[model samples]
Target chain A: MSQADDLIHQPLRLKIMAALAAEKGAPLDFPRLKAITQATDGNLGSHLTTLEKAGYVAIEKDFVGKRPRTRAALTPLGRKAFRDHVAYLRAVVEAAEAL
Target chain B: MMSVSEHEARGALAEIEAVTRRGQTLKGYRYAGPILMVWGVIWFLGYLGMARLSPALWGWMWLALDGVGFAATLLLAAKAPAAAGGAAGQAMRTSLGMAAGVAFVLAIVAVFPKHDLLPYLALPGLFVGFIYTVLGIYLAPRYAWIGVTLFVATLAGYYAWPAHLAEWLAVVGGGGLFLSGVWLRSA
Candidate 1:
């Protein structure tokens, strides 16, 4: 069976990745992502940093007027990895069913 | 390899899809309510001017009023928080398409001079309705009914009361848009 993406295997990270990947070209602002994952600021920040370190997600920090804004987007690599992980999960489910 | 039971794997997949869908759903339609409501009011006021004043003069007056409304909408949008960004590109594309549509309609109207101005009046409502429908389908599903309502009301007005086309567009179409804004604001 294909291996799952370890970084995306965690529930919160998986949710974050799924949200970012869904929009493709559209970068999601930090508050919107937080609302989707229901994660606190610190927790979400750390996971996003981890994904950034892995090159799976790119975080852009900029200002909309005087206010600071942080937008998160799934990298091409991250999108591919997410698809692969989902495929691997499906394979595991199918294998178990066959057995 | 992360080993997991079939149930666990399936659950994770479902969870991911759910999160993705939630992310895609619109979260800030209220931000658009003020713009819609303001435009609707301007349309109604234009209708009144057209009824009381001459069509040639009122048309220019209405255009000026619409320009003000456009500026107001821009200010309102700028002041409102930005929760979404993808819709900006989509809106620009739709506006460009609608402008082309308006140009086509104007060209046709100019070529075939009809004594009845119903077609000219009806054309703008149709254009606005088309934009609303497109935006509703692509950005906000809640606006779908509003779009349909605008189309139906304007078209029906064209057929039923040709002379009162402006009235119908203002009372029914504009009113609907304003009400939609209220619904969005409260939603």
Candidate 2:
């Protein structure tokens, strides 16, 4: 039976993964990610930390002209996980539709 | 979110699709607009040069303009902060690299003196249209419209006025890029 990935099952986290996955190797800045996911600063930061800890995302922080800029990209593992999760979701829908 | 009801599954799928679609569009083509516009203006000038200058001089001017546009595009791409990653990004990179290869080959062929092949001089325009079409089909379908418009115009120019094919390319294809830039920005 297909199952949703626990790490990526949350709505906001799923959205984040989807956006990151779309850009594959490219990193998205913090502001852009936040705007895409529509998450608050602290909430987003915490979720990012969680994903980073899981090795699902890589976060880079640097100073750009005296201002800190953070960028995030999905790891290969994270991309696979997101794909699997979506597939699982689709399977669920298909199975229900059959019933 | 874990439970997989029909409604929940549909919602989740939609959510995923929405983000992916948005990521595809909002990946910062906004900066490419001015580059296209600049190239368009340059090509337009090249068209005027074709009418007034000697063929050799006009060819040189066209080469210079192409070189400038190519360099400017590279510089702008380098400066863009967000780089698209996954499949879409890979496809984009692949298409661009392919276009460069095609342009290089076309440039080489263009150097050989064959007035008979002058009609094919506008091949670079066709190549650009092909790249746009590929990019549009993969990344943004809206851009495919521009590609289609360019391809059809180039074909029409080739058949309708082979004598002034290059000029038509500059007018139609260049204008198409300019308009595409504007359209993408609004999109």
Candidate 3:
């Protein structure tokens, strides 16, 4: 069985990763991400920074018609990690069911 | 390495599912908004023309507007980001679905060649409503509500305001769809 991905194990971070993974390489703006995760601005920002530091996410900043926009996308490494973590979680459930 | 209990694992999986569903819903909204707006404009103009012009002119006007709508929808779908992959396939599917819808409408016209103008106007609206409701059942709940509203509005206009049915459909059916498109775009 694969080990748990500690960085993505947090509930909020997990939600973020799942949302990004669903996009299939499309970048989601910060506000949309926050809405999906239901996280506060400060809390979501801090978690996103952690993911970026770990090279699990790429953060893009740009101006959209004079308004600043922040978008997040899963890095290739992050996608692999998320897939492995999900597999691990499924294994855990299966093991428990077997016992 | 961190270890999680089976319960925790299950919970995490559920969270992932929920977020992924939300993401897919938002994506659907984004893709569908412009297409709906295009059709909304077509409906608005078609009905308005029917209301103001001679019956002889209505058929040609609708044909022109429908052609424009189809072309515009295809262009928008083709230009959408290909990052999700299978973009060409998606566009092909969209074109095929649209062709099917047009063919269905043509079949209805062929079967009922002598229908009244008011009922004719209502038929398309009802068909569109049914389509939207079905899409909502699979894609998002909001679409179902929009579909129901369109269906009800069409029936109400047909029954209550036969004299002004074309105008009523123009404002309510067309305008309602346009507003729904705007609402979905924000989602």
Candidate 4:
């Protein structure tokens, strides 16, 4: 049985992980993540920081021309965790359906 | 480990699926933007040539411009990362679709050889619009918007200003595509 990841279980955080995982390692910019998650800057930033601290996401800040851009990508561990979480969710649904 | 109710789990999974799909569509748009822009420029040039140059020169001009567009598309595809999920397969499918579209257009022209220049000019744009609309419906809503806009504009220009249809296509059809490409790239 797959185990649920508490840190990734939050609705917004799960959305963040899903978006990053979909990129297959390519970094997505902060604005793109904000769009996908539909979260405010502070909320998204805070969740990203949490994922960063948990070693599940890597955040990079860089300058493009004069503009500062922040991008996030799923770490290998994070990708595995996301897959496991998804599997757990599916298992839960399946178990319920089987009942 | 965290405990999630079946309802919560199902909802979370649904959200994840939606986000993942949106991410993939955005990524597809990013990859396709430059290619569309390249075609936009080609259309601009080709229509401009048709408007300005002799009727005999239009064919050669378009052929050359199309060659450039195809080469540019290939180069861009080559530069894109190979690991970007199904990049190669997508390219192959797109290439085949493009070729089939071209062949279908040619066959139509051959079968109906008596058509006026207006129909000939309108055919490509209409076909392109149809393709974009259908693909957009499946892939992204923005594409469908662009496609619909192109389709309506092409017909409007055909009826409203038949004399300057080529120039109108150059500006509206070509320019619309270029602008949409820029917009998609920013997404």
Candidate 5:
């Protein structure tokens, strides 16, 4: 299986990835991403940092009015990895089903 | 060799990109428009079709289905971390809660609704949902298109469709969209 597939298998990260996939464009904000992923800021930030380092997601920071904001979006490699992971998941499920 | 774990650690970013278009973020609502549009239209059409037949029965049924669909969507979307650990694992559960809230807010006006309130309900309900969806997209851009679609369709429906249809549209159309949202988000 590809590395993306293995990472996605992690459950929480998979869903976060999937949730991000649903949007397909635009960066998810910290608070909103937290709400969607049901993750704490620190926890989510931690995961996001991981994703960012992997080059699967891009993180951008800016100030909106008074507050500092951090936003994340999927990178090109990130997209392929997700697709490959989904394919692998399908294969795994299908293979399991065939048994 | 890139062991699956190391490979994932190295390449997981690729998954994020695959799911979302380049240059997209969850903070912006650009992607959330489509699902929202489809959802609004489906609900509006449902109401338009059903209201002409049985208002009272359909009204109650709409409320029930709305809750069912909304609940299912949220249950899948709004999950907390499982001892199962893994961000991927809890992500499914995370969707359920937010999905439920989104669907609820999207469908709330239709529940055991009065015709008057029902007619006026879509306007605010959709507007709020549109805003929420947009925000959600910014948090996670992958599915933001769903929110963007909903937002656009909602505005179109609100501006173009008649008030009478709101009753039926909200119930039936909302139910269908909620179901779709549930399906899409489940995986």
Candidate 6:
């Protein structure tokens, strides 16, 4: 399977993507993403890189004058992948609930 | 730089990428407006709690509850993902640490009263509140109203509850603030 395909199976990564996707506007930075996912840097970044390299998310770089900065946004592919993952997770949750 | 784990390195990349988009994450969270919900609630609960509770004792109980709430906020904040400590984060973090430090000093100072030293408590107390208010209001908008609400709530509690019962209001008020802060900001 492709990287995106592999990604949807991981619960924490799925949650991170879902949170970012749910946001409006550009993208999320490390701290905001950390707050939403409640994941440490190592865990979230490992997942983010996997998505980034797969071309599922894009990273931007620049500054507010002198201040350094970074951000992450889901690519179209990433968004779709996340939705699919959510649906899959929902189905699993529903199935469990039914059982 | 060297201490970063692999995961942190990635987080740094993600955050560096964010700088181009807009304000850093701190500004984004401030504007996100979810925290505003917490802002409104924390104040409202404080208002109600004070209306319900008393004076002198309300001070102590609320003080304890606030102590606990502050601790919990720090704990939750610690759980937050490690973004590379940038200017904003470093400043915010330093100010927060100093604010806590001042409070600790005041807590100790509060117990020690000298005719000459007694006046010194005000310096630390005001200093702690000032740092707190500046962070909540100026830097961290998400939690901006927390300090103000807390201050107002205490005033209200001082007037409302009995001295003995005010302590309970502190516990209840802190719980109210925490729940509302999370619900409104996160939910």
Candidate 6 at B153: error in angstroms?
Answer: 6.0
- In model 3, the Cα lDDT at residue B49 comes to 94
lDDT of 2 by residue, B1-187 (tens): 3566788779989998998777656554555565567667776777667756877686678678767766776665565544443333443454377457556755776687676655555666677678778877987676678778888888898888988876787778778778877865553
**DockQ, 0 to 1 scale, candidate 2:** 0.35
Q: Model 6, residue B92: what's the lDDT?
A: 47
Residue-level lDDT for B144 in candidate 6: 48
**Which prediction has the highest TM-score against the true structure?**
4
Model 1 CA lDDT for position A41: 99
Q: A1-99 in candidate 4: lDDT tens per residue?
A: 999999999988999999999888889999989977889999999999999999999999999999999999999999999999999999999999999
Whole-model lDDT values for every prediction: 0.76, 0.74, 0.86, 0.86, 0.54, 0.51
Which regions of candidate 2 are displaced past 4 Å? A1-99, B6-14, B82-102, B105-113
Model 4 TM-score on a 0 to 1 scale: 0.92
DockQ, each predicted model: 0.36, 0.35, 0.78, 0.80, 0.05, 0.03
Ranking by DockQ: 4, 3, 1, 2, 5, 6
lDDT of 3 by residue, B1-187 (tens): 8999999999999999999888767766766677778878888999999999998887789889989988988887776777643444444465567668867886787688665656787888898788878877976898899999999999999999989999999999999989898887787
Instruction: Point out the higher-scoring one by TM-score: 2 or 6.
Output: 2
Question: Of models 2 and 3, which has the larger TM-score?
Answer: 3
Which scores higher on lDDT, 1 or 4? 4
Candidate 4 wrongly placed segments (more than 4 Å): none
Kindly give the number of clashing pairs for every candidate.
0, 6, 0, 0, 94, 17
Consecutive 10-residue window with the lowest summed lDDT within model 4 chain B: B86-95
Interface RMSD of 5: 10.4
TM-score of 5: 0.38
Which candidate, 2 or 3, has the higher lDDT?
Answer: 3
Q: What's the TM-score of every candidate structure?
A: 0.58, 0.56, 0.87, 0.92, 0.38, 0.39
Q: 4 or 6, which is superior by TM-score?
A: 4
